[model samples]
Target: MKHLSYLNKYFLKYKWRILPGVLFVIISNIFGVVPAQVIRNAYDLIVENAAIYRLYEGFDRQAIVYDIFSYSLFFFGALILFLYLLRGLFLFFMRQTIILMSRHIEYDMKNEIYAHYQKLSLGFYRRNNTGDLMNRATEDVNRVRMYVGPAIMYAFNTTVLFLLVIYFMFSVNATLAIYALLPLPVLVLAIYYVNTIINQKSEKIQEQLSRLSSFVQERFSGIRVMKSYVREAHAQTIFAEESNAYKTNSMGLVKVQAFFYPTMLLLVGISTILTIYIGGEQVIDGAITPGNIAEFIVYVNQLTFPVTMLGWVTTLIQRAAASQKRINEFLQLQPDINSGSQEIDLNGNISFKNVSFTYADTGIEAIKEVSFEIKQGQFVAIIGKTGSGKSTLANLLMRMYDPSSGDILIEGQALDKIDLHSYRSQIGFVPQEVFLFSDSIKNNIAFGLDAVTDEQVNQAAKDAAVYQNIIGFEQQFETMLGERGITLSGGQKQRVSIARALIKSPQMLIFDDCLSAVDTKTEEEILSNLGKLMKGRTSVLIAHRISTIKNADKILVLDNGRIIEEGTHEELLNSGKAYAEMYQNQLLEEENV
Candidate 1:
């Protein structure tokens, strides 16, 4: 019930639809009861007593014809009219409510899931898979929608129909009705058992489905890597294993469901047989009228259908509940970093004061107590070997993850105090690996803004040295990039990413080895343009080569999550430390070439 309570707000919002649907159900049930009354009346009048034939004796022939026509017309016409009105109107409204509710629930659930994803720290995404998140956003939300619509409507209908049938049955013959319902307890217990199994199995099935989805997504995204390594067979074997696991779990659930429905029908069939035999005896003994026996049997049969439907509804509800729990858990996760009370005023200066960070999973500090400061309009460079925490430092500045201890300040305010969205808007990041959406180049470049003009997009492209490349294409800016911009080469993708960052016109720019893919000449040209771009902004460049950072105002050399050398390039070279060794090694390689 607590899990189901998540739907209460949506239910209230759409209660108008639900109310009409409920009214329709009630009207349908009332009309449904009329048929039972008609059966009883027909049995008593036409079968038991012979007085219905006496009306023809005293009537004129034409009048008798008229009377017969009227009687026949009234009985059949009324029955047909009520049946049509109840089934058509009631079913229509019920379907409409379900459709509306499903859409509303799907929209709201997806919105909430997306909002939660945005709030979560970067570490969460690092640990989770993109395909699993996509599944939650799409498939999981759809599961909730199914429950909001068909599952709720059918459950409500079954409950109301059952109660009405039971009421009518008891009214006809309490003793016999009670005897007929003797199997209900057993039926309910069986349904409960089936539902328990379904919930457990369905949860496992959903998990496996997520894994399979993740595998397919990863394989497709990394198809080139897989092919390059010739691991196609291995990938297929892994995918098949996941696919088989999903199939086995789904089939196991089906096996349980197979037994459940048959058991329910068998129990209900026995109960119906008992009702007829006992009711027939009572009728023969004159304890009950034939009409009463007929009505009781009709009502008992009515009860059976709802009971059967109720069992299926219970199973759906259990599966939906399990899905809801998984979705709700993700929705409930609190972001590790969020805006504090103080507001941010960006003047572009960034300061790291003894900052240290350790990822939750590894529990080893990725960045030690490193301190650094970049004044406004400074072009500072960070050079490091692999695993040197240079990228981690940039992540902290971007507020992707807060330091486990110590403070990072931008302008004069602590990073936490700044509104995350507003603060991030003022910063641009081009990661070591560039990611482009499958969209037009223009759209990708202008992604940060709500509205982008063609001129602004063109100018940004020109500034990033990608304008010539775009114009060379037939569609130019309108040309669609394939998935993750697969149509573009590495250098072209990097340039496009640079254009995207430049279009934001951020106050702080962090380029994490973004120029690594381009030739030295193009790199030099970009760096020159970037120098002009960084005139009134603070910039941090994370690079591997000496040429990339040699001209920076200050350079910090890092190794193993600690800064070993920090000074101007010439100062570091003269200091005769790790920086000199790296510079000399690169120079030696160049000379050999």
Candidate 2:
């Protein structure tokens, strides 16, 4: 019952529909006893009046026997037909409403989890792998639905059916019914033992499946690397190891299921033997008629099937409970980031006041007590060697992460105090590793906009200097790309990414090394267009090429997580700082080439 509370939240919302379905299940099971009763009545009528004996002493056999027998057969026939027809209708409604309700629950659960994933902070994803989350969303959700559909429906059906059969069996011969059910305690123990083992194994099985899924996902995502390195054999060897683990867990579960069914059948066979042996003596002692013993056997047989089904129903419930627990834990995750409600009039004035941040996993500072200011509509460029905190600073400006030690300000208001969506909706950010959805060129360009036009997409592409390359394609704007735009050349992909950001016409744009893929000629062409894009808006450019940022209104040169150089390119060259050396070295390399 404690475990059921988690699943009930999904069920309670549909109680109105579910309650009626449950009522139908009960009615259907009660009607299931009709044919056996018809058989009992037909048998009793034949044996009691087969001949003119003491049992038929009062009735006139010659005059009334033929008419009475025909009437009896005809009435039972019509009654059995009507019972089954009505029962079938109830069964149909039961399946329709309850089974479909489980599907609705599955739909809601998957959507809720995906929405939660969207809300969760990046750190949460860092800790949990994609395959683990995907398994919970898909497979675990499906198992939970099984509980709401078949487990609940069949458990109710078996309970109602067993009760009705026992009541009728008692009326015919209580002693025989009790005698036949003597092995009931053993059956109960067997079910309990089997379900306990199944529940434990099911959790292990689910974990192994997730592991196998993760291995496949990681391998497929890096298949190009595997092929480049010729490590396909290594991948196969690792896959075989994971698959063997999954198979081992599956076999353990199968062994329990195999033991469970046979154990139930063996107990049922014992019940049948007891009924036949003891029922014969009862008939001889005149405690009950021969027809009464026959009815008792029919009731016991009927009860045995539902009793046997108990094992399967219990197995489903046990598996579902394990799955529900996993789902409940996922639903309970609280995102590390939360949105603030206050909206501010943003004017793109950015400031960082003694900001410092250390990643949670590694307590080494990524950005150390950095301070800077950029007035509205200024083109501020950040240049540093790899892992020198340039991208971290850009990410902070995007509000993807907050400063660990100090506050960031936008237009004199604290960055965290302003509404997250309001602030982010006005900023365009393109990361170092560009990602594009697998869609047509037009749709990919217009991704973040609520509504878009072919004119806007084409203009943005032209501005990013990729328009000629796009039109050269067979489908132009309608060309479909592969996953993550893998079909496009690296420079083409970067330009498309720039186009995606530019179409938004954001108040501020953060380009985190976005031009790394293009040659210097193409970089110069794109930078010329970017000058127009940045004229009246704040821009933050992070690049390795000094030529890219040399024309900026201001450049901040970072070294070892500290802003050691700042001012115009001319000022840094005269000062002979780290920036000047990087510029001189690039010239020397070009001359040597």
Candidate 3:
């Protein structure tokens, strides 16, 4: 309930509908109880008229009594039918108000969650899996919706119906009402015990299901790798293990649930028997009539569904509470990276002032006292071995993270102070691992822009050395890609990513080993094309190969999260240091190949 308090605002937001829905529940229950009273009156009328018919001796008197009984029965029956129909109409209105409000709240909540997901930092994603995130947004929200809609609706209905039925029963005979309701407390306790077990078991099953979903999604996404490794049998065995665990948990819940219905029916049966027995005693004592026994039975049965619903509603509330707790955990999170109010154009003069950063999740220092500068139009390249923090530098420049110590400036302005969206819009970043949506090649290339022409797409594709390959496809630029662009080869994926960056025509461009998949000749061609396009724009290239950055205005050699060498290509070649050795070793490797 503490966790569910977050929904109070939404309840208040739709109070108009909720209030009317509440009114309808009460009205329907009022009509609902009136039927039992109608039955009691009709029963009494028939008995009294039958007595009169028995006393009368003439055939005409008997026939008239029979007609009176028949007409009264018809009138009462029609009235009962009309009352039930009217009750059903109000129930319909109740659902229209409450259930419809739940749908609207669900939509708003999903959007809020998705929007919050986007606001979250990369670390949040790193610490959570996609499947759990998806389940919280979808499955959890749906559970909460059940609480808001059906559980709430049924709870109110049960309360109102119970009150009305009990009032009518007590009005007739207090002793009979008490005897009839004796079994209800035990039913509630049994339901409570069972629901607690169901709640615990349900959580376990939900967790296992999330794990199963994640395993399946990952396996399908990496099916190519699995096939190459021939691990289908192994994958199936693991999947079966997860599935068996899920089934075990589910069966545990089902076992407890198996007790739920039988206990409810048994208690209800006891209540009905008690009502008949007690009402008959009262009738024999002259405290009530035969019609009273009939009415008490109807009242007892009327309470049965609502009492059964008590258990169900409790389960729903528990599930909703659990889900809402999970949702609130994320909703309460404040993004580590906050966007600034300033929206300004970036000229792309970049400076890293003794910048140092450590990955919070891994606790690995990815940068250490790194200091460098790039003039607005100069091209700077960073070369490093594996784990040398080359990509970290690009991440810093893109403002994906802020430095643990010191600062970064863009156009002589603090990077974090610039509006994140506006700042990112001015820069083009191509990452080491390429990702493309399941969209057309043309749309993928022109992703960030509001509008683009085919000519622009073609030129960018040509510049990235992927135009010929795209043209070879049956649908050319219109060919829709598979997941992560599996339709393209690795080199084509990299080039398409490059084209996506190039199409932006940004003030700054950062390519983080984006050409790794292409051959040397194609890499050179793409670099040559980029040189022309990169004029008067600050460009930062992070790569492993020295050949990729040999012509840069400045080159920084990194090792173990520190810059060990800084010089021009010619100077580094003659320096007889780390850079020189790397270049000589790379040249020999090329020669050997």
* Backbone clash numbers for all candidates listed: 0, 0, 0
lDDT of 2 by residue, 170-207 (tens): 77778888888899998888877787799999889888
lDDT ranking of the models: 3, 2, 1
What's the TM-score of each model vs. the native?
0.95, 0.95, 0.98
Q: What lDDT is obtained when candidate 1 is compared to the true structure?
A: 0.84
Residues 1-593, candidate 3: write the lDDT tens digits: 78889999999999999999999999999999999989999999988998899988576788888888899999999999999999999999999999999998899899999999999988888888888788889998999999999999999999999999889988988899999999977886887687678778767877787788888878988999999999999999999999999899888877776778778888999999898887888888999999888898899999888988887888788878878888999999999889877887777688899999999999999999999888888989999889999999998888788899988988788888889999999888999989999999999999989999989999999999999999999999999999999999999999999999999998899999988889999999999998999888888999888989999999999999999999899998898999999998999999999
* Pairwise lDDT winner, candidates 1 and 2: 2
Best by lDDT: 3
RMSD values, in order shown: 2.5, 2.3, 1.3
Candidate 1 residue lDDT tens string, 146-212: 7888888887787787888888878777888889889999987887778779989979988998999
Runs in model 3 lying further than 4 Å from the true structure? none
Range of the 10 consecutive residues with the lowest summed lDDT in candidate 2: 49-58
